[model samples]
Target chain A: MSVNISKPSFQPYTGEKARISRAFDYLILVLALFLFIGSFHLHFALTVGDWDFWVDWKDRQWWPLVTPLMGITFPAAVQAVLWEKFRLPFGATLCVTALLIGTWVARIFAYHLWNYFPINMVLPATMLPGALVLDVILMLSNSLTVTAIFGGAAFALLFYPSNWPIFGMFHVPVEYGNGQLTVADLFGFEYIRTGMPEYLRIIERGTLRTYGQYATPLSAFCSALLCSLMYTLWWYIGKWFATVRYLNKI
Target chain B: MATTSEQLPVSLESDSKIPWYLQDLPLYLKGFGILTVIYIGLRLYQGAFAVASGLDSSEPAFEQYWMQLFYVELAVIAVFVTSVWGYLWFSRDRNLDQLSPKDEIRRYFTLTMWISIYTFAVYWAGSYFAEQDNSWHQVAIRDTPFTANHIIEFYFNFPLYIILGGSAWLYARTRLPLYAKGISLPLTLAVVGPFMILVSVGFNEWGHTFWFREEFFAAPIHWGFVIGVWFALGVGGILLQAVSRLIELLDMLEEAP
Candidate 1:
């Protein structure tokens, strides 16, 4: 009598295994959406909070400089994991999109509906264009150094121009009360926020005022320099946090 | 032939019908639905009472409208943390060493759902209501730490997410063999790091005592919360760990006929 036996062979996941993997992917997608929205928004709101909160705060100097400097952080960190491990390159886009969604929801519910603040006053600036460029640079070059220098620079430089259309009209000089003030300033004045006196508003302050129209460009470039360093640092931070090692004890 | 189960003595049901791997999906969907209703209900409550009664914490109306709700929230949190955490702990698998590959894979799926739910809660605390705190502060003076938004955001939302995150941590540590043998670093970071956000609330309210009027969202005083949220990035590490383990488990199973 002869006995027939089958051997176990390793094969690529198919059918049920493939389905299970896809299900896990979907689950991760949901988890990632909330994760990015919650974590990134909190970070952005705290670090670059006021600048992103009000249109009047969207000044040429601080707004353009600080927004990208802070905004590049989560994207760079997320890209470090998504790109390096999974070879997915949409990390920057994902973070920016999540932040946008979160800010929009807050602006609508928190500011507009709750406090009756005009939507225009609480409009959030977009970093989508710059985020796209960051992702593309990382995808194409696949080198951290190259992505940091060029991609980080592009992220900062694009902030002002991309948001120019939404806010450029607000910056148009208007003669109000025999003093020169922009429409954004007028909005700030009309809507009196508690504890936020005119003096507290940090906009266009410094010797950079001597440069006049050149201040924005100067700030953008300075931000670009800082963002490059910030991106590199956060990339490492992402990698550090993404460690798969298990400890014997915490 | 696939590797036979030697460690685990748990027997599969000898029925013609094959069991679905994602058996816990329905429960996950129900969890999402319940959480949505609860969050939306809280937001609606804020909308109704915030402007009228929330501006003055010292008043009788404030006590009735806000403080009562605060007390109720505290009660709910206490009951919730105890029940859910106790259930997860008490129901932990004693024979994790003998867990079948299929059962382990299913546990991973369940673990993901727990984390996904936790992140959903984080969305409310960190994103929606956190920014709304600024809007509320702009309109209403922060005379006390237990302002309208703080009643919901800091006290309720923070603790709720912390509980859910703790639930996920406990679920993994108790059920999964690998997690049982060695504590997962990324998992701990993701859970414990966010728990510190609750601690930061004390520091934050204390800092606000000096300048209770100004609502500078990005000020250095708020940096503690920022530092706390960054640990959420450890989800990336958790993903790496889960994916590698799942791959190994999937390889050990026989192909579906």
Candidate 2:
């Protein structure tokens, strides 16, 4: 909270020129704001872009585990900085919004214009309750440790269930070439991936073979435990970032 | 009103002790220029490599191109890392306890510039090219260690971050006394975390080989990378340490009470 890092206090403008200058500054500020947030969006999408890209990868076992594991990092970092530095609690919202914008940009430029992939296939799943829960927990507790433990669990556990509504359509069973196929599996067959053959996919292989419907929940639970750990470690990261010092050497 | 470089809105003066270039030349511009060259070069390299490798969608034609590029990038990265790191260690300040506050402030500017470049580099690596993987991988088959996506994203973009992050961390350790206090934890994490993504590349290569050469962005192997870049969060602490001191120094230049 040094003077420069904190917002500079400005007095009311008395002159018309000063007023015009301030207006221009606001306009420029708006532009920079979009660009900065746009970067956040791009960065956020990198975490889950692959999961959303292919139909074959959206199986019960790996998809749930992989998505939440990488997805939560952005929120954890953003929450750490915004809450600790500015006492603001909009990290969750910012994360989700940034991600939406990033994926929208991706689908628009990459899928829509370049390849003309279907929007339904390219659209990323919304975080839904998970993001909101993190913000609420942080707002209530006001302690990074508490937020990490409870908030992180909520983020992970909810990720699979929250996204189920979106991916459920693809999972619905439909008749195909030799036997029954889920819409997801059929999409994989229909789309011609010259580089990605059917043999390359590793879906529903391990616990999925043994546990059927119960596999995703197990993944979700494991995700919560790891998410809690990542959040706790990253919280210290936030506190460490707040350190402002000039040392005299080791 | 200050206008000239000599009268710049900075309180500290080196008294010709610090080099003229550090004092006169703008730090941000130096960083900006170098990063621009690297970025444009990378784009050119990727474009050319894609064509050369058959990443232009002709799956069968490009089989050998990616594997060869991967090995070459790996070798180049090894040399690049060693040379830059050796330069930093060899050129470190012999006596940190004797440096002036002015020098410290000047060094901080350089460090900030390094980070500014590092931030964008991370964006290009972790997000832009990383996301670009979806477009390319979904469109092609990934049979080798170097897929079209991996050639640009992992080999080119990821290595750029290592260079930028390593340089920034080295600059701080060699010049700043603050880092002498057992290596600033945030700074270490800032450097080490992204550096871990390099470790993750091992996981990525192994996973691709042992398992199918599939492209799933959120696979267990890939988590290390995305999380590694998330360590860029540590830049927060580095900023706090710099921005406050910078403001105080600027106030001094203004002769404010």
Candidate 3:
């Protein structure tokens, strides 16, 4: 006559439920991986796709502004959830992996679809170190405020140095037209994009005489300021995303 | 369906020292079923369109079909949005207190699945095709928004996620007790964040129109779209609450049988 099940100490999820749980973990991991790859593509395409495509758009003035601004939200928000939920700081690494995977996906198709634009021309520069810096800062400091200030600055400050290995050779001097041009500018010119006219390029039109040698450092500093604020904003946004409270049952 | 005869395996609900969690088998299966169908549908849609258009940006049929397809997509999206919202309004449960815990868990499972679908659509539409948009835009002269890339990326792809988000919201609002009385804040965020990306398309167009006409993904004007991505961070919040409730249900089920 009793409807209620009685209690004893043993595992109920031993065979079938354990199998189901393992399946569930696999399912969730696949879903999470798909999300990671797709989000990077989505975020990077809208935020930095243009600068990434053409070296001409990689100006000291704007690249710093756009890259870090676009990049910080992801790591900050990811760090928020990871740190809050699991005490993990792998957000930056996850983001970097996602971005690299996204670029590889894009580059594969671009190589075939767009008259085989050379891999060197279309492959995106890596930002893995920036993401690592963001994660390491959070782990070491264990303070969002400190992470936002110092970690954010490091995230911005580190981008150029990290990516420079792949792109530094391109920044080398080359003789083109009337004066000196970096090999990057020459590569962009040689690619022959029919849609992208030479005039449409929004590169720094002014001479190095106008910019002085300190242009890169100044740009990195300003980007640090911009990225710190962005990191703080997104860090709070991440906290909001990490919310687990609910209203009353009814 | 545990009975006392089945050695009284510790009931997750009644046992004083027992934990309250079971990884409900039924609910998990149902959610998985729903997400799989949606993913299959997405692949079909993408495949069929790719076959139809040949993905050539400059072919005459490409432009002609894409422009018309854009209009058709707008209409389809409009219909979906209104119908789901209207359905939720009519289907609102009057008896919130008596709602079954089993059904509530099922609703949460469905909610999570829809959100998963939303994320899946985001993968195909936002990240996959969106990046592809960058690749092809540099290849083709973009005279209008109805280019092959925009057709796949903006018109067709972006709206796919919007519809998914809308469905998740509708499911929660109509069925889940937490969302029954009014909107749940995290749920609203989960819904609104991606919808705003659809809204920001206008800003994206305006910016691309006036100033930055390149495929620069990290342009400042493009910053708004990332905000939409940040909103997707709500998935974390939503999962936390839903899993907590699931654990509670597991406890109930553990004791019930």
Candidate 4:
């Protein structure tokens, strides 16, 4: 159903109008940078907290599954507004990059400097490659369906490999005290945390570990299936929040 | 009858060098500078004292270093909220109906600055300090609710950001014509939703009482904050509302040279 408006079409502004608009854009740029860093990081920290924070918690099962699942949420919601309204496809990259900056700073100052934990123990994982791909798919396809299915899968699938380089050395096996533990597990033993309780560590449980070699891919695929659904759900959620409705009262 | 020069809109006759759209830029920058110092100062205080006297709550030094700061934070929050909100409310424009398009446009710019500053406060409270809470908890045992980080984070930082967010909402409601006439849903959702994060502190602290320490960061007990921060996405709608109104206002003005 096509609809036509009698009002004159809006045209590109020049001179003072352009300057005012550009200035507003800068203000928005600054606002959005902080907004995503603060809000998305909060959400990521609380939901994907242990997995992203500790190297030992970055296991074959939960870390691969939970990280991408939580990571895609803000990017999808942001893409809904930014891509749908302004035609800006950088929403995923913007959110991911902001999250990285927030995580890195916290890891250095909060974890390493203040608490004196080693940097490697608290290093944050990167989702940049996946975020880049998500933005690209949405920009090229311009279909929420295609983006959700393809972009969402790519986001989950690329998370592990992208982060592997930063975390791989920690996964190297070492023999100590009649038990073999990865270097990451050694960090957990060396550092005493309130979260160091045996029951609290929810990593690599169930029969999935028996599949040792195939476990990560299996988790990633499970996350891929979940993320596609999450991306679509959040897209609508983003649209709903972006509503321009005015209420007469509370 | 001919129109007199005195009858022209004040915006049209302004001789001031500052652009009408950016008149609030100095105040905005000042607000940012002040907040940065406060956050950094708090961080420094934690560095110096958190490990020394903050480890034990029963000691007199804990009362001095930590509890005193908590009490002061509560006082500052009370005074700051009352003064800022009261000033915004009492000094509200009573003649919004008579607001010129140019003046209305300028108010929108100011409103954006208020929101920008609010988000800046959120960056400190939500990203930097919020994660630091985990770092602090991981190392330091939870003896009291008013631990060093909690004193700075829960008491000071969270409330400071809430005040700024509320101020942004109040500023828009009192000064802008559309906001004064009808409450903007997006604006309300964006402001009120994050405000709930402050409310969820009760739940969070209560849960911590059971364990006396953080067991897992992603546990169900901490989900309250995650849910609350999602409402920040309402900013998308606020943008749409502002842009649509700005377009109409800008169209009413003559093209600049």
**Candidate 3 Cα errors over 4 Å, as ranges:** A1-31, A56-65, A110-112, A176-179, A204-214, A241-250, B1-103, B206-224, B253-257
lDDT of 2 by residue, B40-129 (tens): 665555556664554543455564565566677788778878997899889999898987655665676567656666766765665556
Writing each residue's lDDT as its tens digit, candidate 4 over A63-167 gives 999999999999999999999999998999999999999999999999999999999999999999999999999999999999999999999999999989899
- DockQ for each model: 0.70, 0.21, 0.34, 0.78
Residue A109 in model 4: shift from native, Å?
1.1
Q: Could you give candidate 2's per-residue lDDT for residues A1-250 as a string of tens digits? A: 6565765585444453233334333432332233234344444554555566665577777777767666676677767777877577877767676566656666665555544566666667677488899989999999788887898889889987787777888888988767998887776677665545566576777556488668888888888888888877766655655455444443
Question: Model 3 chain B, TM?
Answer: 0.73
Residue A46 lDDT (model 2): 47
Backbone clashes for every candidate come to 1, 5, 11, 1
Taking all chains together, the TM-score of candidate 4 against the true structure is 0.95
DockQ of 2: 0.21
Q: Estimate, for each residue in A95-161, the C-alpha lDDT of model 1 and write its tens digit.
A: 9999999999999999999899999999999999999999999999999999999999999999999
Quote the positional error of residue A209 for candidate 2 in Å. 12
Q: How far is candidate 3 from the true structure (C-alpha RMSD, Å)?
A: 8.7
lDDT score, residue B25, model 2?
35
Better of 1 and 4 by lDDT: 1
Kindly indicate the candidate among 2 and 3 with the higher TM-score.
Answer: 3
Name the lDDT value of residue B253 in candidate 1. 86
Best DockQ among the predictions, by candidate number: 4
**Candidate 2 RMSD to the real structure:** 8.4
Report residue A56 deviation for candidate 2 (angstroms).
Answer: 5.0
Best by lDDT: 1
Lowest summed lDDT window (length 10), candidate 4 chain B: B7-16
User: What is the Cα-based lDDT of residue A40 in candidate 4?
Assistant: 98
Q: Report every candidate's CA lDDT.
A: 0.94, 0.65, 0.68, 0.92
